[model samples]
Target: MNKYIIYLIALVSGVLGVFAFSPFDYWGLAYVSLLGLIFVAKTSKKSTALFASFLWSMGFFCFGVNWLNVSIYQFGGASLGVSYFLVGLLSAYLALYPVLFTYLVQRFNVQSAVIFSVIWTFTEFLRGWLFTGFPWLQLGYTQIDSPFSGIAPIFGVTGLTFFTVWASASIFNGVAALFNGKNPKIALFNAVLLAGVGGLSAYAQRIDFVKPVQNEPLRVTLLQGNIEQNLKWDPDYLYSTLEIYQKLIAQHLGKSDLIILPESALPTLENALVPFFERLDRAGQAADTEIVIGTVYQDVHSDKLFNSMVSVGNPNFPYRLETLNRYSKRHLVPFGEYVPLETLLRPLNSVFNLPMSAFQSGAVAQPPFMAKARVFAPAICYEIIFGELVRQNLKNDTDYLLTISNDAWFGNSIGPWQHLQMARMRALELGKPLIRATNTGISVFIGAKGEILAQAPQFVETALTYDIAPMKGKTPYSVLGDMPLYGLSLLFLMLRGMMAFMRRRMNLSQKP
Candidate 1:
């Protein structure tokens, strides 16, 4: 292949990935990123491997996260140069993972089709966990629409990534063989792996792997204020925002058993929420309902603020703020919610220009919050993506899963949809209904099968009311956690290491 052609291939494949995974269509484009890796391996020079990897990553992040321009230029009020610099720096950092993977693969000389598959997948697993762990844009997500999605219930995303890369390498190698005017055996092997991924997915979809017993039916309502982030804190908008939510709740106050609002829907601290809490108590009493609203709660003792979801109105009586169900946001954005390296980077907040960039960390092992009639396991924003976090929250009495996010900052990009897609996977994995309420849009209710039961459109100010049965049964993923998947990965690493050691010994023995 020509030199420039390889670069073009990387760029094209990266763009395709952006399109496929974006909110517009199916997410199969993530698998296409592996193609860029192949291009680097086959055509790029060894010394230039890092450069090739960086270029491929640039293509992926630059296009995939184009929506960042909105937040930076429009929201953060940064200059074009600064915004572009930040995006470029982030892409360069993320690109290092793939570059490191490429370097290791080349060093190992484990080029067999099967070995290569494991090697690629192991790197992805590491990428997800290394450095605070940003598992965004995993190739397995693209296969969600394909038959390969069923494997998520069994091997998790890592296994699907393994098979996807295997299929990619097979097709790339097979195509290369045909171009070189040779036999197509390698291509056939690639086709078989691809077929197998699809076959398993189809089979898994048809089979009822999870048998969740409906313990009781719960009626709920999600309130989406569709309030603009800019004016949310303004005193002028406060009354209207509060009134809008109040009016929306009044409609469902008596009708539904429970009412839900988006993250920070109240936009007030615990002390500041006395009046509203009183009104909610009175309303719940009159209507005979339990209202769970996403509000900002501050711990008076620590004075550490939390993005929390609290429930009001219970059967136990007295209304001095029933401290029932609560979940604080575990994963905060690097610069958005809180600035990292506060001493060093604090100055950059002024230079780079950020909005409300300080937040306190929440306890990881906190107990699940109690609600009206059920116990709610809350995951604020990005916490939903962490599979282990959800699994750890599972308890014998845990009823439904709740995730509240302020996607208003992500704007109208693929960010919200990707979030919704990931949230859906968690529901599927645990065999529990997940209710996600967002500030801007994509507030949805997902069934145990990962199917969308009810949803509100993006960039809308509306309310959704639905009845989902709280489930008691656990899925394979919830019971085993990542133990099975991590164990298999460790086993692969040990076998690979042994094979390498034996090969080295044999080479030494054969020496003159």
Candidate 2:
């Protein structure tokens, strides 16, 4: 085969893998893509394999997250040329993970499937938190609807990534052996291994890790304002946006137990919207309902701002700004919520000048907001992607998980759908019902089993009203988190290294 042709195949395979995710959801494509990657890595030289992996991941990130350019060029006020350049730069940087993974595997001559799976999973885990973590388009996310999804509650997304990669490697080895006609037994074993794992996963889907709490389902109303991202912060549009949400709340106030609003539903600062909040609090009191709304809150002492969700008209607490319960977003988007290396990048473009771009992160260990005697773990915007962050917020009595996002920044793209999928995974991992409200669309109520109960259409001005049964008990993934899977990966890597060393010693003795 031609060398350049191999690289092109690798790149195309990565591009094809995107279809396995949201909007497309061709799950089997992930396996085919991985097989292509394995072929390139095994056939090429070390340097060629490194380059091929880089090209492959570049294609993956470039296609998967191209929606980022929408926010940069259209909303962030960056020039078209700069937006494209930045997008390319970001994709290239993310591509390094695969490049390094392939390079290391070849450099150390690590041929064991266990070692490869461990390294791939560890690389993914590192990418998630290193440099404030981009963790988007993780391999495990593609399996959300696959049969492998059954193991999500036991192992979390990282575990799923490991299994997916391991299975792909097994399939590749089996297929290659069958074609060569030199290792029939090995090929048969691989086939049986793959089938057995799939069978177990199918059976695992029937297991209920968490039981429904015997409490009455919460009657919830999610408000989608469909506010334009460009006009969201304009002073002129503030009152109109407020009025739209106010009317929505008024309509649902008496009818629902809880009324939820999208992130940044109020464009103005909390202090500026005191009167508006006061009125809503009065309405909530009158209707005997709780209102959870997203807005920007600033600290008077430090003058620092935070992206926050505040609950008003809770019969248990006063509507006072200081006394009202709130959950401030902790995981902020780099260069979106706050710019990194502000001194260096702030001068480059109007992108860093976005409204609330300098917002501060909330405390990591903040408690969940209480509503109607039930605790709700709250995540704002980009925060939902971090499963451990959500898991840490959950407690023994936590009932529901809530995430409010302003996905209008993504415009008409797969970004919002992917974001919603991640939220569903979080629900599945924690065995908790999730209430997701978005600025423009994709607001949904996901069940404990990660099933979508009800959702609103995109770019629509509407509200979704539904009753969600809060679940009790914890999934094993929730209890152990990702530590057990990490440990398993480490165990496999160590075992492979020990076996390799023993084999080396035996060969040396035989030669002597």
Model 2 reaches what TM-score against the true structure?
0.98
- The global C-alpha lDDT for each of the candidates, from Candidate 1 onward, is 0.74, 0.87
Q: Which residue runs of candidate 2 sit more than 4 Å off their true CA positions?
A: none
Taking every candidate in turn, the Cα RMSD to the unseen true structure, in Å, is: 2.6, 1.1
Model 2, 237-273: lDDT tens digits are 9889978998898889789999999998899898887
lDDT of 1 by residue, 334-371 (tens): 67777667778776645343654566777877876776
Residue 37, candidate 1: C-alpha displacement in angstroms = 2.0
Q: What is the lDDT of residue 126 in candidate 2?
A: 79
Best by the lDDT measure: 2
